[model samples]
Target: MIAIETTGLEYTYTDGTNALSGVNFEAKEGEKVAVLGPNGSGKTTLFYHFNGLIKPTRGEVRVFGESISKNNIDKIRKRVGIVFQEPDSQLFAPTVYEDIAFGPKNLRLGSMEIKNRVTQVLHRFEIEALAQKNPSNLSGGQKKRAAIAGVVAMEPDILVLDEPTSGMDACGITGTMEILDELNDEGKTIIISTHDCDLAASWADRIYILNKGRVFKSGIPKHIFADEKLIAEAGLKQPVIVQTYREFRARGISRGEVPLSVLDFMDSVDVKVMNIRCAIAGCDVEAGDEVCLEIKNGMLIANKGSNGVTGRAVFDGKKGEDIAVRDVAGDILQHEGTITIIRVPGIIEGGSRAADLDRVRDILSKNKHQKMGAMGTSAKVLMTRLGLVCDFEFDVIQSGILAALRGFDVTILASGGMADRVAEKVKEKKLKYSCFVL
Candidate 1:
């Protein structure tokens, strides 16, 4: 189902500034959509229309197939929550607790129910310590979290965040995005506006490039970023991973699809190694011949001995075929590590699953040299309660894959949809690694 849709959305300011023009957009149920644009683009203006905060001048905005009107404006707002770019614009309550409770109170929910919602959000966002703090005194990241918590307390089905990590540090950005992912896993439609191309490429399932009050392009991140001309025309730089992949491709070092993350890049490197074959005819070297191999001008060059050789390659010959070199430039990854995923229940139900926790403990104890990671809010919170120290908190799936590539077994704790996501990413690597989900 379409959670939100806009047809020919046009918005004009009181000063006659046209903010959006003839824009058509839609977000499916339980999808993560990203709106990317330069400054002064119609990103935020389009977002305001999602929840009736701003009505179009000559278009229509629909939430769940229902047009927005004053009669149902309140209902629309209740189902669509917007977190502005600037938290100061949305946060007005004296204390963080009160600010979060404000939305639930407006719903006419009982005081106890409101309290429970606020408390749950506080802990969910890891802002419990800031519950009594003044919003005005909180840090920029804290304010952002508080504002989002307030909106989430209303239990909206659709979440629209404008520059959700604009002022956050690296750690803050990762934590915030993880929380958003967890919300998305719980069936909320997440729509965010961001200038961070890297974040959009890695996090969003679909992207809309808004330019000059219109959508310039819309597609999956891989296709959207792969177009060099489109990125240049959109006035955006390629994401770091994409840029690196292009450089490797240009240098004849890496091939295959454009990688979106470090883990993907590592997999590409492995594929390149697996595909390298000896080009010289009748050049046969016995095992342990100490032959040297070097990549010069995009071609692999092999020599007789290691005296002048830059690297070593493992040769495996097939009938009537040239010898295939497996490891051309680096140490052969002979023993690929295993990735073990443990799916824990949500935080509220975590305490009731003591057996699961014991199983996790047993797994951890057995894997002495394994790297530990956690994904989703529930798994992180459960690990914290269990006094477990996670080596990878943010980007757990990619981190686990990278660690496994380096021959270290990995144990990842994830919940709900995240466990499946981990499995999907692991399958993409195509390495000889074992993934067991508990």
Candidate 2:
């Protein structure tokens, strides 16, 4: 049976911004498909159409053979559970248990049945300990898990998640993947809209690329990931493994096949792998060396290190008072509001750093407006932490971060050489400023 299907799905905002256009797509029963795209690529907009959260401008959406219309919305909602990109958006009740039980209660389940469903999902997600804690008080990863538990408690057949792994640490991503994998094994259809190429590469059996309200590509991940043109069009980077493969291929090395994961790359490693190879030949030396050569299994054993770029973040509010950043990186930050609209300079694009994105997301989440500043992959992760709405517009990357930084009351730009330039500009403009320097 078709779990979810849409024919020529199209949606447009009140302001006439086209969110989706003629999107024809479907997922089979028990299939795990990752809907990969940049922000505002219509991933979420298309998802909303599935449960009648929003009606399409044209075409139709069906779940389990039933068309999504006002009359069937209540029924559709029961079978399609959405775990939003930001956990905060899904959480409302003060306690986790109450929050989890809300959906079942709304469904009019008996008291005993509601309790059973909530307990089962909480234990399944291993969040029983947080049952009594305020949803607002949980950490970013914890909050994400709780939100998911609440969704799964409904026992939906089709699971739709928007940026499911956003704002999670490495461990958190792995754990969530495992749970999803188990659920899929139990016959659930999983659809996740995300920019986390690594996760999609590892978890999704199929991939769909959307851009500018249209479908750009759809196929098995192997085919989709290898489509260089399609990847570029979608405003995404090739996985790091794929990048490494390209580097090897450029040096006259025959890497018969490019691997998608690091482990796969390691298993296929019969020849030497160099990150930045030397320009000259003969002796294998670090990049920038006068001479270099290659050897089978040749690898540099360098310890993992931080970027060494740190700084104090200070946000100047509307009336002149400054909000100091208590903790730097690794701390979960949040905001709440309805964004009216956003005009960015263009910096929130593909090139934006991950750290820079987290800062922007934190700031946007606290405001209230509908039209908000769109962000790139890096910014998406940060916004995930703050539970803000962001877009992954191709033009945003093309426009440049400086342009993206222009309009915000408080811009959270990264420091280091970049910060130095901003500091210079501030001095030249004689704008009052206060920030912690790394």
Candidate 3:
């Protein structure tokens, strides 16, 4: 069922401000949708209609097939919970618990049930520690959580958020999106409004671009951002990562769909870069081990690795084995010069399911940790299994090596087949570089 739908959705302010015009939008149940536009676009105005907070001047709004009118406003409000952009506006109760409990309390639910709901929201948002704090005393991130906790306590089927991460730091923004991801996983339909195209592109399944009170474009992010004319007409630029990819494309250096994030962009950078030669030394390394080495690129290059096995760097980017990085290379840090890579896939031969991908979501987003993995037997089939919301095409070993050359801080070393082959090439060139294993 469609969680929310609008036809010719038009709204005007009492003083004659034309907020929205003929905006037809739809979000199916359990889907994550994003509304993107500039400051004066109708994003906020459209959000108000989703839950019947504002009466439409023209057109109609529906929630689960029922028209949003005075008679059903209360019921729609319950199912279409909204968390406004500003936390101060939504949080007026004296205490955090009171603010969270406000909605359920209004339903005249038994005191015990309200208590249970308040507790659940606090835990879900990871705000149980702040349950007794005054709403005014909370930090900006805390207030945002408390505000969202209020609406979530209502058990809404569809949740509406307006620039929920507007004033947050990196950690705050990541934490907030993580919660929303979890909520969506729990079956709540999500609709959000923001000017963050990079974020929307990386997260949303579908996006609607609004301009001058109308939806100028609507589609998946890949197609939407590729349209130069539509993006220009809507007064928006492509996502930052897309712009970088295009710059590479314009110079005839990169190809394929634009990457959605830094890690993805790393994978997309041409992987056929020149291989470096180094002197061989240190303990012998196998399929799953860590090695430290250095090289030259004007600056001395160092290789870093995570504690886990780096099995990804050895696989033929297609079918030899499943791929994953050391939670550091070809996935996390972004830098601006050349570096050398030394570690190889560290997992013992025939190893599989080394770590749980689901648990890494928490580590990756807020902590800014790097990650790459797939639960398959080949690189060709090892993507889209983590529910990351972004698309990627990477030759694990080559991508890692190229990323390291382009100044990636950490990367796995090449082992066995590729290592031996590259060693022969180094001998053929008789360059100063030598081969080493660990």
Candidate 4:
């Protein structure tokens, strides 16, 4: 059965930006389809259409072969469940339990039936203990699970998630994937809109590329991901494993094809090492991993950025330092030279200057932490919003300053503290060039 289908689907926002145009696709029952695209590529708009949240500006949308019209809107909504991109947007009930039960209650189920459904969903999502906890107090991953549990309680035939695994740590990602897989196994159709190429490649049976408000390509993961030209054109980076293998090939090494996983790469390396042969002659295969493998000389490394100020430093083109060194009063500390160092002066109430608004904006863009309340919910977001890329010590900061003087592009460390010893570390590291003293 056709779970969902769209033909000539086109949508234009009120701002006059075209979000999607001429999109034609269909998902069969129990099929997993991944809509892959860069940011602002209409992935979210496409998903809204799936659940009838957004009426089509043009074209046709059918759920289970039933056209989405005024009479069927409510029915279609009941059959399709959408998990929004942001969990905070979906979770509004005071407690996790009430949030999960909201859908069943809206359906007007009897008190006993609603309790049973909510209990089953909470258990299924492994969030039984959080039933009484406030939604705002839940962790990022837990909040995501709660949002999903609420959707599952609806018993929708088609489960649509927007960036389902976004912002999750390794463990959280794995757990979510397992849950999705289990849901699929139970005969639910799953459709995901995501920018995570790795997740899409590993989990999606079929992949669709949406670019410039149109369908650029549609095929299996292996085929679409393997096409270097297509991936580059689509503004996506190839899988790291494939990139590594390609580099090896360019160094005069021969491999049959790019490996999809670590184990596959190791297997391919084994084959190449065992079958070493000159380019001028036919190859002879040797048994086992006994053949000698010779690597060409002259190593070259792609320098992404430098660490100090003096030694062949290349800036990341980010104007101004991440930390805005200011006095106890709010002031924009100016940089004196090419290298500047900043630090919090000491522990005084509101002693350090407020964050540089521009720098904060840049960090927010890079980390996608612009969503409201993200900083309050996740410590990682707070650190990142403050322009802390990686954890570093006071010693690193001082060393970075010295390295900057030596022509090494030095990076100032941001570990919030209020002490003379810590502040001295910032100066010693040569991070003091334009150091913002909070």
Pick the TM-score winner: 1
Superposed by TM-score, candidate 4 places the C-alpha of residue 421 at a distance from the truth, in angstroms, of: 58
Q: How would you encode candidate 3's per-residue C-alpha lDDT over 1-438 as one tens digit per residue?
A: 999999998999999999999999999999999999999898999998898888889999989999987788888888998999889989988889998888998988999999988976786566889999899999887898789889989989999999888877675676577567656755789999988887898889899999989998999888898787788889987888888898987876677777776655755666343122221222333333442333333232223343321112321222222232222223112333221222122222211133334433433433321223111121111123344321112333334334344433222223223344334433332322323333
Per-residue lDDT for 1-438 in model 2, tens only? 999999988888999999999999999998999988887888989888878888889998889888877787888898999998789899999899999999999989999999988876775576889999999999998999898888988889999988887888775675576567656755789999888887787668888888888988898877877777778867998887787877866765536666775534543443333223211122222322122111111221111123221122233222222223212232111111111222222222222332444444444465422333333222333344456544322222212222222222333322123334344444433333333221
Which portions of model 2 miss their true places by more than 4 Å?
A: 252-254, 271-438
Show how many residue pairs clash in every candidate, following the order shown: 0, 27, 16, 32
Give the 10-residue window scoring lowest on summed lDDT in candidate 4.
324-333
TM-score, cand. 4: 0.61
lDDT of each: 0.80, 0.62, 0.65, 0.63
Give stretches of model 1 more than 4 Å off.
270-331, 348-356, 367-369, 431-438
Off by over 4 Å in 4: 248-254, 270-438
The lowest-lDDT stretch of 10 consecutive residues in candidate 3 is 373-382
lDDT of 2 at 149: 84
Per-residue lDDT over 1-438 for candidate 1, one digit per residue giving the tens place of the 0 to 100 score: 999999999999999999999999999999999999999998989998898887799989989999999899999999999999899999998899999999999999999999889988997788999999999999998899899889989989999999999888888889889888888888999999999999999999999999999999999998998898999999999998988888988877777888888876865664434444463312455444445554332234455555433333455333333444434444434436777777666544542143366777776787643678888777877788779789986688888887777667778888667778888877877544444444
Q: Give the clashing residue pairs of candidate 1, or none.
A: none
The per-residue C-alpha lDDT of model 3 at residue 299 equals 31
